[model samples]
Target: MKRYDPALYAILALIFALSCAYVPLAGRGGGEMTIEVVRDGKTEFRAPLGDVPEMLEFRGPEGYNAISSVEGVRMVSADCPGGDCIRAGTIKNAGESIICLPHRLTVKLTKESASEMDAVSY
Candidate 1:
């Protein structure tokens, strides 16, 4: 077998680190964002995230959830056994989501369109 140099491993490690760091940033963008509530693959609620009512309630298979859509979207409270969904925190970025497995519920943020500033003028 041919012997390999340590430099090769170091280069691979650097590439992996940079790619992992960029993956999260790639999911974020400046645009008009909306909150989508999906239950069992069906869209139940969809609205501008920041413009939604201060408090919204949803009934799921497991129980109920109180959602807050102030500046961002979040599950303020839920009747599920585990409070993981509520602990998922606010989702202000496009492509972010909170899933409640037991309740078969998902709250996601979607970008309606890329902001004009993201375009380059010739």
Candidate 2:
């Protein structure tokens, strides 16, 4: 007959409890998202995730640039010489970002809290 160690049981219980606490947060990532556009180190525009896809245009020292977002965000167009931002592609996750150095622009996606979503919907 094998005996179970109390210390091992306690560790397993603790891990189970921690995993339970983490599941809800882990599942919250696909919640509503907001778009933040920063230019020249300042936030230039903020908007809710759009249902219809569209491009947002901006003019900077480097020239014109466009950012687009629907369920996912991307740099659709830019006048920068290398056009690296345009190639950065789509980002759908919170904390993901795309930067255009020539234009000093940044586009970031962020998850919205349940309370904030409720307020917006109502």
Candidate 3:
């Protein structure tokens, strides 16, 4: 029969606690942005934009699509089955987006910028 060592268990528990403590520090100074598509006040699609084109092709299963740029964001396509989202074209701004009535999807862009000092905590 094999016996478990209490010291080993304690060390493993300590390691897990340290890792959990560090999780919040991972986001110290890095900014994150989420683009959400909504219709009738319901969220449909969300995307992160490092560039304009990457945001253009973001799509969700519920017939939602979104695109974004430094200036704005919009919906370029959707799978609402009526193709209304496709006609909306592109939008480049913070609060700009396109919605499809049939599919009940909306696309919007959000940005988050954190100060560099936050990194020091990590």
Clash count, predicted structure 2? 0
lDDT measured at residue 37 in model 2 versus the true structure, 0 to 100:
86
Worst 10 residues of 3 by lDDT: 113-122
Scored against the true structure, residue 9 in model 2 reaches a CA lDDT of: 97
Computed on alpha carbons, the lDDT of every model, listed in order, comes to 0.82, 0.78, 0.58
Per-residue lDDT for 1-122 in model 3, tens only? 55898898999999999999898766555455556756568664455655335545534445454444445554555556777666776665444556666766666555554332222221
lDDT of 1 by residue, 12-88 (tens): 99999999989766756667778899999999999877678899899865799888887777889898888899999
Which ranges in model 1 have alpha carbons more than 4 Å from their true place? 1-30, 114-122
Off by over 4 Å in 2: 1-31, 51-53, 113-122
What's the CA error at residue 11 for candidate 2, in Å?
Answer: 36
| Candidate 2 structure lDDT | 0.78
Q: TM-score winner among the candidates? A: 1
